[model samples]
Target: MDKSAAQNSAAFLYPPIDPFDQRMLEVGDGHTIYVEQCGNPAGIPVVVLHGGPGGGCSPAMRRYFDPAQYRVILFDQRGCGRSRPHANVDANTTWHLIRDIELIRTTLDIPRWIVFGGSWGATLALAYAQTHPDRAAYLVLRGVFMGTQTELDWFYGGGAGRFFPDLWARFVELIPEAERTDLVTAYHNRLFSGDMLAENRHARRWCNWENALASIETRSPGGESPSDYARAFARLENHYFANGCFFEQDGFLQSNAHTLADVPGTIVQGRYDMICPPKTAWDLSMVWPRGTLTLVPQAGHALSEPGISAELVRVTNTLRSEAVALGL
Candidate 1:
């Protein structure tokens, strides 16, 4: 599609709406997370999980669902966005996030609700649903990430680098020759180092590497993210990746696909996604039984990509009619 067509298709998002309720919920481990509720209070409940393992929710995320038909819940995971103790990874893990989701659910009195997520968010959604299968009414996932070592290797271990040699070089050039072999660990060391300047410098490089590859339209590495956002995003992401996302084993989500056999889902993937490739989404659909995978041609990985945003909105709009059937 041409630039004009792509810009026009971007209008798929619902009209902007303000949150009717917002607050900070203390989720233990000395952490407090920011949570907000938008749209109809009595409408079907759907929680939005942002990516990065640290990428906090944004107002645009609230625009994906119709305000009159759904209650959208968005929160910043521990140490990111409005969440407290920014950039600190202590006591943060996949399991802690799942517990926080449960806490939010029970606290809101939502017996069951639709789970919407993408990228790392998709990883959490699957883990959360499988752990508490009865709490998920349905799932709307995009850019599937299973948190396996192979997936990690593809992105950080040079598989993706083969395709973007220039960006990969920029990403690795900062580290010493000996440390170039494991960029994640190398970046992890600096990201956590006590020197704020060095941390922020490395953090920007880490984030830029991912951001440049996020969209296919980009001709350059793009601009650096603000130091604060970069620190949180890079640190939390590297922390999770270095630890294998706190999973019991690689392919944990895929091995447990049976748990979601009865939970119907829709996976929206980008045909050219460099961040979370489409193959994982395809692999997921094969075992999910009830899951439907929709690949958006010519799109890359960003949530704002026109094709991706259009399909996600289309999926949510279609699900509105099924709210009653889903026991929303």
Candidate 2:
């Protein structure tokens, strides 16, 4: 409710720590991803995938796992954060990301790992696990999104628009009236227009719209984001969405849940998440074996939300004890 109270609420998170190791890994396609490792080098391996497909990993990501019990890995996906050739989407695709994850895993010499991700990160985690089920020992997902056309439409089409009409109008208003029918396409043009000023302006508006709805307590769109960060984030996210995240059809990820039958997963969702609604998470749990969904009643989509943070930290701690008994 208040600043001090809010701070106290999220105290479940480990205090922030600097990365014990950081490097720019060459993952081919002329792309070198940014990767970092924190916590104990010999701790139970946990790869932390960040959201946005572009929301690069942050120092706070390292706090989700207990430093003594989990070896946390964080990386900036291709074309984002500290990764090279910022915002360039030439070879970026869901499959490419899946391969990159494997490369990171093999390079680090981790036999297997617990996959932890949220939002778009959740989507990537699911894709990676389904592709390499044997490589993922456990999955801890938050604000689950399957990256289907319907999910994309719900957020960018008129679904989330109905709830946040004012913000929606501002978002759609940036494009020409003729182009309003397909907002993503319209924004894509400006985001990759190669005009720095145009890209920055549109990127800010795009990032602001999402940031505004990320938390239940947020009333106003956040202040302007850094131009470089916003541009890369907007471009890469738009690139993915514009291509339907390179899926065969809608609900591809959920349809492939059977592939994760041997993999146990914990899905943590925000009941009121405006972007990736609760229906997707509920649907996935019903179909996946040993999959459990925990919905936080008062939360939204942000990782920083107190309730969401608390639950994630609780999950990691619980898994730590389980890993010990299983000799992982």
Give the per-residue lDDT digits (tens) of candidate 1, residues 1-328.
3476447555888877899999999999999999999999999999999999888999889989999999999999999999999998999999999999999999999999999999999999999999999999999999999999888889998998999999999999999999988888999999999999999999999999888888767746877899999999999999999999999988999999999988999999999999898999999999998999999998888888888889999999999999889888
* lDDT (C-alpha) at residue 16 in model 1: 79
Off by over 4 Å in 1: 1-9
Per-residue lDDT value at 117 in model 1? 98
- Residues 232-316, model 2: lDDT tens digits: 8999999999998998887889889999999998999999999899999999999999789999999988888888989998999
Which runs in model 2 stand beyond 4 Å of their true positions?
1-9, 324-327
For model 1, what is the error of residue 145's alpha carbon versus the real structure, in angstroms, after optimal superposition? 0.5
Q: Candidate 2, overall lDDT? A: 0.90
| Alpha carbon lDDT of each predicted model | 0.92, 0.90
Tell me model 1's lDDT, rounded to 2 decimals.
Answer: 0.92
* Count of clashing residue pairs in every prediction: 0, 0
